[model samples]
Target: MIVTIAGAGHMARGIGNRTLAGGHTLRLYDRTRAKADELAASLGQAASGADVAAVDEGAVAGSDVVVLALPFPAGREVAAAWAGALEGKVVVDISNPVDFSTFDSLVVEPGTSAAEQIAAAAPGARVVKAFNTTFAGPLVTGEVAGRPLDVFVAGDDEAAKRTVSELVSSAGLRPLDVGPLRRARELEGFQFLHMASQERLGLNWSSGIAILP
Candidate 1:
């Protein structure tokens, strides 16, 4: 599979490693070309690193899955700008739109969510909400606490959800299909607490949420 990640920061690096490790070719795009080149270089030969390269944003047109590893508002803009290109493709929205100044509430309207807002902007794309609950630390290894972290997937399209689920499993993590896309409301809210917990309890970004027996 050709996976395109549209960011050059931590989340992109971690997710890029997982994708290359999964044996999928990767195309990375970032406003700063050096960051993407640096990330691809860091993956090294062990991950078939040669298969990954820094590409133009237009390269997303050829990918099977396009990950919007960006903030909520930026993701909305990309979704709108690339709506036609994203048609029938799995577009992963991994943003948590919390009001960082207060962290007490979401920046989205009461009834909708970040993922929903992005979906609205990209009507032609199959939008799926995932990875927001998983912090950047554990994603580097795709595990935490000696256990696989659970990735809650929410999307209206069943086939699209399954595609993301398979990608999650291939990366050695657990994918929990939470429900339709609107369930992203709860996923985002729940992860807001998880993010707050990291700072509140001094977990040092080492914690992850899971569903256990």
Candidate 2:
């Protein structure tokens, strides 16, 4: 499968690492070309023989899945800007809309999540909320403390959710389908608390949330 990830931040690199490990082709895009190129090179070095490259944002057209590894506002903006292009495509929103300055609450309005907003913006796209609860550090390895990371997936489209779940499994992680897109409200809220507790728990943002059977 071909995966296109936007944004060249830590989350982008982490997800790109897993995508390559899963043997899927990875195409990275960032507003700043240098950042994308740098991340692509870094991921390539870590995953030898991996198929990865830095490409223009337009390249998302050919991707099987397009990951918005960006922040809340940017994710929504990109979704809207590329709405037409994203039609019939599976779009993943992995942003946690926490208020960084306060770190006490989410930035989005009550009852709605960043993923929902992005979904509203890209009406035609199969928007799925995933990877929001997993921090970048643990995502790179897809595990923590010898346990696989649990990626909670929520979307209205069954086929799109299945596609994302398969990708999560292929990357050696667990995918938990937590109902429809509205479930994103809880996922975002859950991750907000997880992010808030990081410092108190002294997790160093390296913790992974796993569901034990």
For TM-score, the strongest prediction is: 2
Candidate 1 lDDT over 1-213, as tens digits, reads 899998888888878888876778888888889988887777755474348889988898899999999987998998999999998889999999998989888899877899999999999999999898888889888899999889999999999999999888898989999999999999999888888777678888868989996
Query: lDDT scores for all predictions?
Result: 0.88, 0.93
Runs of candidate 2 exceeding 4 Å displacement: none
lDDT of 1: 0.88
Clash count, predicted structure 1: 0
TM-scores for every candidate against the unseen true structure:
0.96, 0.98
